[model samples]
Target: MTQQEKNFEGSLKIRLYNTKSREVELFQPYFAPRVGIYSCGMTVYGYAHVGHIRTYTNSDVLRRLLEYAGYQVTQVMNVTDVGHMTSDEDAGEDKLELGARREGKTPWEIAEFYEDHFFSTIAECNITRPEVISRATEHIGEQIGLVKRLEDNGYTYKTDVGVIFDTSKFGRYAEFARLDLEGQEAGARVAVDDQRRNPQDFALWITNQPNHIMQWNSPWGRGFPGWHIECSAMAMRYLGDQVDIHTGGIDHIPVHHTNEIAQSECATGRQYVKYWFHSAFLNVDGRKMSKSLNNLYTLDDVRARGYSPLALRYLFLNGFYRRDMNFTWEALESAQRGLARLWGACAELPAPTGVVIPGFIEKFESAISNDLNTMNALAVVSGVLETKGPPESKASTIYKMDEVFGLDLANSRTRLSDFWRLRGLRPEHKMQAESMADKREKARKNKNFSEADRLRDRINNMGFQVEDTPQGPKIVPMFDFDFAAMRKPVCGHCGVDEKTGC
Candidate 1:
């Protein structure tokens, strides 16, 4: 049994679809009790579309699920502010050139614009920054280090074009793709770039031409690190050379990430990463979103059409991670309705006993533990409401589940169709706010002044503050720290803000 399964029973222990085994195998971390994670992030050469959000949210969900399972997770995601090429196969100009040409801006301007906005988008979605958010352009020395190492180990050979890693030297070079080497060249991407020693071998570094805007000085000369080399160097520098989990879009599995694994493992003479995780794509009205197809949806596109970002997240959550989901305005509207209904139901329950329900928490935890089956865990959340329980227990449970869901369930009351804009809550369902309000009001009515203040503080912990007035006690929320902040931050595990001492 996996750690998740062992800890939580009655719920499906998360059986991850391990790319290694090609089956939903029990999730086992390389280092027991502590999990180290790396996620492939944006290239920042162009504007990010909703397609990008799909990948980030998938990673975010995995982080949330792992933490809820009672293991310490240290995650690292990179920012590719430089060195990604137009063709991931190492043939064309840098992608930043394409963005600059299309937008009539400098390559640096394009990178900074999208890179800044990318962080903004993540904040909007409530996805916390990784412990170490590295920039590929800043790590030129590190990439060069790995390139030299691969060269020293005979895993690399310098070609007229650049220094390339010889995939032929590594056993099972295309292992991730489950490819038969006999037919590798026949099916190779970019028509088997003739410069490569073997058809599968990719560039460790590429020479920068006059047209290439993102260039850096290296041992090879004035050039840039190949896209594959950046992730390998960055992941190793922060987490060890071998990591626990590597996540990204399924689209990366064939070419980009495949090259990364070959170069990384060959350079280090050890496993590159364990537990590869790839999320399915999002299709809109039966068509997949992509730049070439010109069907990508931007954040502004969704908002100009009057949709919230969370509405997009809620739509994705309605479907499972491994399955391709169809996105539509109607589908998102339906998710909004579901969210509203959930908040509506939350506004109507009775007062509490201040007791937490361990049994119910265990059940919900198990549901999410089993392969991040949020679809099932959500069903259990609804069940918690239906069952007989203290109002306090039910409220605490929803708050706990939101650790994975990232939904603002504790702060809204617009779901109840029957409930109007009664600022505090609608009396349809039992929410912690209503229960705490009841307690505070009772204390005020009895004139137990000290008890009223303490109950007000209890309400605040559940994400609302209470006040006793002439009419009654009014509740409001000052801060609501969700799952991302619940990790109990490791002191030296500083993020961008923590590193800057912000």
Candidate 2:
């Protein structure tokens, strides 16, 4: 083997729970030294809620961890601009069509709008964009090709509505979901079309009705691809017939992912994916997040309450990816405070200079390697901060941790400065504000309450707010900067401020 191969094989191993095996196992790539990852991307019907964000964030962390472990990772995320139905069972109107009708626009327009919004919000949380972002609507030909292969292979049969995959032909149909065939057969007749060969059988293509808006001419009689077929076709088209890893929400397991496995494997007669990773749900105030409950929150909702997007990211890191995360404002506030404390620590140190502390790095790698146990990984960060070490070492170590954490710790000082700049203060005003805050700190230390209050009022009057911290005082602008006032030039003709006439 080449030296590079040896290095990757010997690198700190990453372990993740495979939903297929239902056990945490060492991650072995199908192709050594290179990993192909396929994550189910947003459906793009509307603004993505926090529940959706949590799933994608977990996948991002997994990708980041693999990259950090020295794997050449090629990631593909499929944007479902078409085919996904209101009912996951392929029985209802397309979500994109519904959204388009509601907004009085084309389905294509609605997809583009929400897809842009989805990326914008996830970017706020520092998610790395996938290498290949395949859209279902753009890959209709590939989807039809895959279904044709399945049909030719005798794994698909014609249904009144479309071509359906014959789950009865795939012996391992219920393997991943551990479904009871008899039970499924009994319930399937009542819940779905009785004409289906088997209750568990799913559609590969859905024949469009007269009013369906996103129809494409296909071998399956001018129909659209089914929801499950999109990811399988796109993944195989981009990443090959077999991939290293596939990730999605747990909700995909029983139907979506299960069907992907069946179709992909039956088409190629090869194992489709080596590892299947699924993230659990997000609950709001101990209840499942739903529009009916009026508890579905978007990234804007978090920002509306003055919380940073990374703060919500930090909140997710506090829990295991495999466990359902309970979201509460109180819990989120706690995470925000914790993140601020870490950022505060970063501000006290200079730019990273020294090598990463070996002990801390080991513990962090170990934590993340063990099934992406980020909660424990975060505790290691807290431990590193409290360790008595050179300032440069701590900063350098935290910077290394942030690679996997995606919290932007190394740029905390810049973020802090920008925080104040957004409120209203100019660069010079920020400096002056800090100087006054130092004076107020000394005044309070000397027990001069009157003087301290006086200094506080003086800073506030200058349109800045001071927050006293153990490290000293942090200054922020009290309100939006009056840029118009700041832009007022001195009137050269009158020797006074142009706007103020002073």
Candidate 3:
């Protein structure tokens, strides 16, 4: 065992809600201090939405907390640049093909454009990039090799369409998901193929499609690998047979992950994964985010509204990862306000002495270790802020907590100043407000209440508000400030404000 593992072996054991057993359990890697995590990444067919942001942020927290607990983690996330069909059952056109058709571009072009946007978006939210980024298109040879092995193991059968994994051959196929096979109806989604063995049978390698933009020579024929096989193959390729943790959104539990378990175990005859972690969905305005409702808000949309991406990340931290989170304009505004306060408080503190209170650290670590309950951890942050203590000590403690929160609180002064500037508070206006606030402070101290009220009104008129703190008076932009002129929607294509009829 490594020194890090040896140190933390007898310490607190991290608990996580494992989907395989549907309960919270103590987590321990097969090899001490060494962990391999496979995260289900985006398909790169479209722009990522807020739901994607929430899922990745939660995964980032998981990885960060594990590292904080002295685990040597290697995280792998796959990019599905090809072979993800619109339908979950391996029917319909490929999503990348559909995106290519939507815009006047090739499938390869669509993949690169959206993949760039997806990573950039997550980076802005301070989500840590995985150690290994595996692409399905680049690993086609490995996928084909995995399918060939399944065929040799007598777990696959060929049909007119493609090579399918016969679920009947694996008796424990439905055990992971606890699915009712008898109640399942065939042909309910896509048209049922007459030669298919069972409804649960999924494609391993698709053939007989001549017009597919991307295809390769496999044992079955000249076609692409199925969606489920791509993840199983690429995960095993990087993480090896002794994979520790697998994470994805909860929607993946039924079809995609279930198929992965069946095919992976049937081929290798070993347990595929130890812990299965799934994040819950994020909703908008108390309804599911959908294109029909036009509520598919992206990080770009959040920036267009003049809110920092970190503010959205802060909102995500307020809820448990296992429960659905509802997003609204008011909630986002409140989160932005709360984050501004945090940044402001950090700015007012003195230089850190590199000393942290042990009680606060213990409470914070305990909260995050309990299945990554960031909500409770955030409460401990509030307690630290409220407790009477030295300024440097509080600063030091909050900065240590930020190691997992990833909020960049160490540079709070610069970030707070930048946040106000991005919110349309001009430097000259900010100076003017500060001057007025200073005069108001003097007037209040001298018992000139009427003069203090007058100065406060003048500061408010300049599109800022003065908040009295123990440190001093702080100048902040008002939430209802008259900055709508600067917030008009811009034409995404031409980069012109919509007010000009672009």
The number of the candidate with the highest lDDT is: 3
Candidate 2's displacement at residue 180, Å, is 1.5
Model 2 per-residue lDDT tens digits across residues 314-366: 99999988999999988987887787677778988887898899998999999
lDDT of 3 by residue, 1-502 (tens): 5565565676557999999999999988767678999999999998999999999999999998888777888999999999988875565688899899899799999999999999999999999999999889999999998898899999999887799999999998888888998888878877877788898899999888877788889767699999899888988999997688999999999889999998899889999999999999999999999999999999989877878889999999999999999999889999998998899888878887958988998999899999998989989889989999888899999988888898878888888777766677666566656877888899999999998888787667567778899999988788767554545543332223446642
**lDDT of model 1, residue 194:** 62
lDDT of 1 at 270: 88
RMSD of each: 12.7, 5.4, 5.5
- Per-residue alpha-carbon lDDT of model 1 for 395-475, expressed as tens digits? 877777888887766654532321222222222212545566786678778999788777665555444556557767665
Query: Which runs in model 2 stand beyond 4 Å of their true positions?
Result: 1-7, 88-91, 185-191, 418-449, 457-502
The 10-residue segment of model 3 with minimum total lDDT is: 489-498
Model 1 residue 374 CA deviation (Å) reads 0.9
C-alpha positional error of residue 35 in candidate 2 after TM-score superposition, expressed in Å: 0.5
Determine the backbone clash count of candidate 3.
0
Q: Which residue ranges in model 1 land beyond 4 Å of their true spot? A: 1-14, 184-192, 291-294, 347-353, 413-502
Alpha-carbon error at 485 in model 3, in Å? Answer: 2.7
Which candidate number has the best TM-score? 3
